[model samples]
Target: MTSTLQPVTALTLDLDDTLWPVRPTLIAAEKVLAEWLRANAPSTAQNTPPAAMLALRAEVAAEHPHWAHDLSAIRLETIRRALRKHGDDPALAELAFDVFFEARHAVTLYDDVLPGLERLASRYPLIAVSNGNAELHRVGLERFFAGSVSARLHGVAKPDPSIFQAACAAAKAPPHRVLHLGDDLDTDVAGALAAGLHAGWICRPDGAHADAAPRAGAHRFATLLDVADALGV
Candidate 1:
């Protein structure tokens, strides 16, 4: 006889690399944001090119450790600093960040993500837990999640047990009843395990690269579809 598995009360999901590839998404958003700056804030654009803009973000991060977990604030500050350096109105920073933020939501989900998440959502309440600033509502994925706990709001990022614990709380489940899915072994798997939750490593689709095995017990999923199957959702 096939053994039946217990259903998890809730799921804590990682947003960035788990739902979609984040690097290219950010790069594309940056390009559009730079174009906007060049058109409206010329001097600021001249003062902070793409490379220097990255440097400015790091500088701002170092100057305000409190804002380190708040990516939106860091980007806004970076723009404000750049505009102020170029003798532009610092208030324009919000407009500039809005440009980037809008572009940031223009993401292409991995083929398996949508269908898989939908299936999982039917079986369990999903809670978003991420260090990234990606807003699920903006990305049109909020419908699948019951709640969200972000680094910016919590004042801490993952690899720290607090964020994971916060997600479990949001999902109305204890840590042991929640399963966390993420692309990074260290941030997702190890962190979830450390927080006394089950962890699952979401392997990339191409199978070109494999991460190191997580220290604690965990599951490996080729796609979010595999995750649903494994969980019997």
Candidate 2:
């Protein structure tokens, strides 16, 4: 007998690399943000190119080992330190954040995203869980997600149960009735499954590369359309 589609009341989705392609979009967004910062916030822009920011991130990782668990805090501290190192110009720092925020909203969703989300949203509450900044849900994705919890606000990230619990709490769904989807096995899939939610993997290739298996057991789809179909939405 064919299994019936379980009634899912909520969805907890991972942001980066799941709903949208991460590397190219982020890299392009960063480039745009850098140019904007250079024009509007020269002081902060002078020293912090992408490479510099990455290196500082590495240094920050070593300095505060605990931050690896919650990267949002690490991101905040990194921005603050970078601002201080650049003569502590608060206005310029604000401009930098503004630039980055605008660029982030400029993202292009996967072709399947809008339709898939619309179909899912018609039936269930949808929320996003990410290790990114708390503003992830507020940045023009309001049409899709009904709620969100990020590592910034929760003080914990994926692979840890707190973030997922918070998302389920926000959606008022028991873990078993919620479907959580993401691109990471160790973090998103494994973590959500461990927390009792059904988990799936969105495994689209960004460029020329491909992810190898070991992503079995989890439902896998190359596009959100496939996911929507799998859910019988």
Candidate 3:
């Protein structure tokens, strides 16, 4: 297949829904977190149901705009606040977060992801660029990436050119020489294009955004394997 790309030297990838079904992973993590809270902090668990916890998290995020890029901080504060409100020890928030984080890493990747990463990684330096707190090492995919640049570490999130620039720097390649592949149109495609990198939209068939239209000048693919094929890797 013909590629709408420049001579690509390095690649930046978005995590979350790009590699795995993030909603299921998140739901599972929330369940694990709720179970942990019930066992260790019954008061907080009793008062904070799933909906209440979601509201608390939203409230925490709204109160701390500076922490927009730090999902971990927002979640931790939300847990702390919930614990405090229910007369539970706020210190348990750390343990609760650990349980949630551990569960978050238990992601079942799309079938094409492993082979696609192998093919692409053989020819290009892969840099993970994401707004999430997922650790590649924890996900057992660290060896496929040259490095990672996350919103938590960079103090900026996607659609912001700075984080994209940081990913390019991590790959040791110019923006124009790097191709970024992701699922989100605005944060990944438009973001990479805005940062002068080629953008590839991974629109999996079962994805929630499967029907979303591709942006002008963006390459669209059904899977990571399609990306490797388009790149002739």
The C-alpha lDDT values of all candidates are: 0.88, 0.74, 0.95
Tens digits of per-residue lDDT for model 3, 1-233: 36456489999999999999899999999999999999999999999999999999999999999999999999999999999999999999899999999999999999999999999999999999999999999999999999999999999999999999999999999998899999999999999999999999999999989888789989999999999888888
lDDT of prediction 2:
0.74
Tell me, by TM-score, which candidate is best.
3
206: Cα error in model 3, Å = 0.9
Model 3 stretches astray by more than 4 angstroms: 1-3
What value does the lDDT take at residue 148 in candidate 2? 84
In the predicted model 1, the residue pairs found to clash are: none
Greater-TM-score candidate between 1 and 3: 3
Clashes per model (N, Cα, C within 3 A)? 0, 0, 0
Q: Model 3 residue 96 lDDT?
A: 94
TM-score, one value per model: 0.94, 0.83, 0.98
Model 1 poorest 10 in a row by lDDT: 1-10
Model 1 regions more than 4 Å off:
1-7, 207-211
Which digits, one per residue and each the tens of the lDDT, describe model 1 over residues 1-233?
01222546788999998889888899999999999999988898888888899999999999999887799999999999999999888899899999999999899899999999999999899999989899999999999999999999999989899999899989999988888999888889999999989888887856333655545588778899988888877
Candidate 1, position 171, lDDT: 92
Report the Cα lDDT for residue 107, model 3.
100
- How does model 1 score by TM-score? 0.94
